[model samples]
Target: MSAAQIATGEIAVGQLDLEYVVAARLTLVAHAHARGARLTVNGHVAVNDAAIRVGRVHGITRDRRGFHVHAVAMINVIEMAPERAVLDAGNTILGNTIQSNGQSGVAVCCAGVTNNLVRQNSISGNGAAGIDLVGSNGVYGVTANDPCDTDTGGNDLQNFPVLNYAFDVGGGVIVNGSLNSHANTSYRLEFFASDVCSGSGYGQGKTFLGSANVTTDGSCNANFQTLLNSPVASGQFVTATATDPNNNTSEFSACAPVIAFRLLSIKRQENDVHLMWTTLAGKTNIVQRAFSPGGSFADIGPMIILGGTGQITATYIDIGGATATNYYYRMRLGP
Candidate 1:
């Protein structure tokens, strides 16, 4: 059956396999089986802007995507099983916004629903998880005895954040990273630093800076900061990984190089103030000076280069500073 628009109150089908090809905003009170009826929803706006008391149940498959399921101000938006029945393998639930349901947004309670992709959708503001893998009965291989076969990856989980990119090394060699995941879920974030960007020792020969267990806030984002046991010179490569409470670990994110300069010491010599700092060899830096700690700073002189290989300690003398007056100094890696 196909339609440009369709609206109904309660739909109960008997023991027959049916396919519905809908192309417009379709509203329904419930989609269920009276005597083993199998249903498939197809077309655009398949079920949009409706108050579905019991969304869909018992062997119902939503194959045609781009469907809008919103304003559901009720219980489950899409429930997989009422009794025990395995959903079809390779069946997909894609690009649908399942939100504002009183219970879970989308629940896959049946087994045998393998190789399915639930990606690029917004699922949030529900009583439970955005997507819950439940039930143990049926031929899906995920039963009460063994429920670990469910794979819920590759989805842009709203309110459930995943690590995006590692950027910015704050507080002198300490690595600061960010992530997106479910709110209040415990996550173990591990950081690794490498000297080489690419080639032989590329992702290899990495030093474990450490790991932190961070819980996401209501916004489903986290800013984790961890100090490295050993300092990493400027231009060193850094990357991170994350593990959820279920011990499901994600692959390492793209590598980001650390760009930081350490100010070592400052000495007053007559009218000139001598400043010394450490930086990676072959790097160029600029020294700036301010009258007070929080005051605006100005560049003292031309760019200085720390030539050759390996780490290097360089010095810059501020010869124009006033005598016996306080002067603050800092160095930043040149762009």
Candidate 2:
């Protein structure tokens, strides 16, 4: 637990004890680091109300008590009673999901990250906005992007919306947005839900630049259902949902099969990494590029349509360019 100089690092709960869970109660943090530092919270930690605060430079340059100058919210949270998981920001973050932390899921009071990607995370049920993204005069602004919705989670009787920020650009990638904010730059949201009223299902939504899009690829009647149906004075909200054609049915076959991923095999082959997996179904299956070694979850190059579903395989070439650090990558499955 020391802060010297972070080049490339990995911190996981699976590697550490449950001490962070206890530290979360006091004013102390579970863990925090900076300077090109890389962190991974792989579905293992149980640190509720875990606040992650990065150093900021406000006051100087009108950064507001040095709180503005710069702040990154790759998956940082703010706006909770005890400020559970209060975070500053990371240089380039990937593979992070924030859920029901204190009040605001991922409270981003005033933050943003350039050249970074946020994927498959839930920013839900805080007192305010699920994933708060805003910047003041002295604070840096957040330029967002949407990966586009791949799943319309309502077709199956088992799928329903849980924590979402999906918007009108595609279908359920961005959710619960503000009209009077952030120069109208579209943000992408990858959301999921536990199960439908009957079975278990999870769906994702997306929103890009100007337009909003939502899709419910699951079978839950009320899953992926927008609490605030309309955008908050934003230009327009476009939604596409798939439900049972009849009043009561469990035919997910007719239902749009959503793009869901389960890590199967991750291997390093020569200079490149070979990523293989299977999908329930996909409409637009794309491969994204990101930084780090054999590691990219962010969208870099133009998306490549890999075509249809079920046990698909794709390879990303490093071409020896990715040497010094870790590169990450993930498949973008949608319908």
Candidate 1 lands at a TM-score of 0.35
User: Model 1: per-residue lDDT, tens digit, 5-85?
Assistant: 233333433221324332323343234332222222431112244332223323333432212222212322333312211
- Per-residue lDDT of 306 in model 2: 59
Each model's lDDT comes to 0.46, 0.30
Candidate 2 structure, TM-score to reference:
0.25
| C-alpha lDDT (0 to 100) for residue 263 of candidate 1 | 71
Which one wins on TM-score? 1
Q: Give the Cα error of residue 149 in candidate 2, in Å.
A: 19
- What are the runs in model 1 whose C-alpha is more than 4 Å off? 1-151, 154-172, 198-205, 231-235, 264-335
- CA lDDT for candidate 1: 0.46
For every candidate in turn, the CA RMSD to the true structure comes to 17.1, 20.9
Give a tens-digit lDDT track for model 2, residues 99-189.
Answer: 4334333322332322222333333333323333333432222112212222111111111112223322223323332211122122222
Candidate 2 Cα deviation (angstroms), residue 27: 13
